[model samples]
Target: MLPTVILPGYLESADVYLPLQQALTALGTPTTTVPLRKRDWLPTLGGRSMIPILRQLDRTVSAALVDNQAAQINLIGHSAGGWISRIYLGDIPYTIHGDVTEAEQLWNAKAKVANLITLGTPHISGERWTKKNLDFVNDNYPGAKHPEVRYVCVAGKSIYGEKKLGQWLAYSSYQQTCGEGNTWGDGITAIKAAHLTGAINIEIEGVKHSPRTPGIWYGSPAVLPQWTGYLS
Candidate 1:
């Protein structure tokens, strides 16, 4: 059986992905969501600790795929999970200020995989929170291409706020959120951003950061239709 790997963001876990996973399972897809151990502040400090975050995802994705004998891995991410997918395929480097000597980008380009589904992910040059992540995607992945790895992005339109996905105050000076008229655009960009980057884009209508039909983090039913299209 093929593998459909769904990843949860910071505090998000099997519970958050349960609804989405069950929905996919109905389609005859063997779905699995790997819940990273709950971290109190790692996500809130993504900027300073992004390297560690990316590393954990890399190891997890790699091991899960191999152990399950998954012939192909279909990737799906929400918020921080979306950011993780971007890091995995696009070799864009995010310099943790001057902290590390060598700049680290998301994903080991060599990791074999198929398809990337990004939900409510921010990847534009100038969104409310692009400075930290965009630094790499913009600089390194401009004309970049990942063979055998197709990508689909689905952004939200609701009024919501999330730690890894939002631009807000944090325990450390690293995290950014969608606070104070930050308007709708959280740290991640919406639909237009992905299209501009040349991805196989699937724009979902009637969804927002949060407070809309689907409830931001866990994801909204309005956006699930888009996910079904991609995850399938």
Candidate 2:
């Protein structure tokens, strides 16, 4: 079995994915997480650039490859980390920061990744603050661009975005993600925005975006079985 690496979402730390790592390992897949701390995300607060996070992701992938003695591994990215993984998979130069040095590039990670699983990731976004990075990802590496890697996009259908107070947060998040608010989502990303055209798209009924959210989340033990089958 290929080893698995988990990349936490924006502002999330490796600790937050401990449950998920343990769950995957328990399922007979050796799993590890990119050692990211909340403070590490501070450098990219304004969505300036994800180069820093990409650096860490590359290091972790390299280490996982060595530790497992495997040629490739499965990559599971959550939220912003998903799109960032798309960038890592592509050979297109990441020029969001004005001509990335060759040394700073991820050296095309797709070659070492057998599967790319995304959890409630907003593949499309309308928010101005996130335009730069999202634009770079969508424009360069569109839905399931790589043929060698299996892309599995998982969406949650726990919340229906509405104008009402109870669902306003999901409404706003959906609007920012896909330019529509009155749709179903995982309290953070709309189902439409989380799926990729050429990927194996899946939707789980009651799963939220993050572990901190009430009820089960993408990384929850119950939800793990829903998407883990794709890794095989």
Candidate 3:
């Protein structure tokens, strides 16, 4: 089996995903995560560009390929990282700091991908900063449309809406992400947006966005049975 490369989300560091990485590694598939720090977002968020993030991901991909000595590897992206992986797959075009001269091709990265899995990734979003980029990804490469790659989208079903006191925070986050409050989600990404049309979509009953709190997440040992089947 090929090794798996894990990518972090927006403003996220690779350390937070250690639980999931350790879990996957223990399951027979060696895994490596992008060493992303908060500063990695500085060039993108501050400059209104995505080049920095994409380039960093590309480097991580290269490293994974070298370390595993395999022609292809699997990708497990969480949240924004999932959609960004789409951009890396080369279906859409992107520029750095709005300069067309800085355009890049992700074909090299695409050549190294085997399976791509997304955990609580918002396939659609309402925020302007992400809407344009996500729209491009969804429009060009919706779901598991790529013939060479198997796409799997995972969603959580722990929070329903803002009605209950316990759901207020999730509700607010869901509304901001999916532009709707009265829906199901994993406290941050709505289930509706987390699923894709052609990909293998799955929903977990008690998992949250990440393993950040009182319970296990999509990457935990308890939830591994839910989506790990697609790792190959």
Better candidate number, 2 or 3, judged by lDDT:
2
User: How many residue pairs in model 1 have overlapping backbones?
Assistant: 21
After superposition, candidate 1 runs with Cα above 4 Å error:
10-14, 37-46, 90-106, 109-111, 125-130, 158-189, 194-196, 210-223
Q: What clash pairs does model 2 have?
A: none
Q: Best-fitting candidate, measured by TM-score?
A: 2
**lDDT tens digits, residues 1-232, model 2?**
7999999999999998898899899898899999999999998887687888988999999999999999999999999889989989999878667646876667488999999999999999999978998998888888999999999999999999999978999999999999999999999999999999999999999999998887899988877778999775
Estimate the TM-score of every prediction.
Answer: 0.67, 0.97, 0.91
lDDT of 3 by residue, 1-232 (tens): 7889898988888899887888889887899898899888877673266677777787888888888888888999998888888878765456534643434564336768888899989888877777667767777776766878888999998878786889988888788777889999888899988988888899999888866666767787888888898877
RMSD to truth, every model: 6.4, 1.0, 2.1
Provide backbone clash counts, one per model: 21, 0, 0
Error of 3 at 150 (Å): 0.5
lDDT (0 to 1) per candidate: 0.54, 0.91, 0.81
Stretches of model 3 off by over 4 angstroms after superposition: 96-104
lDDT of 2 at 190: 99
Model 2 Cα shift for residue 199 (angstroms): 0.3
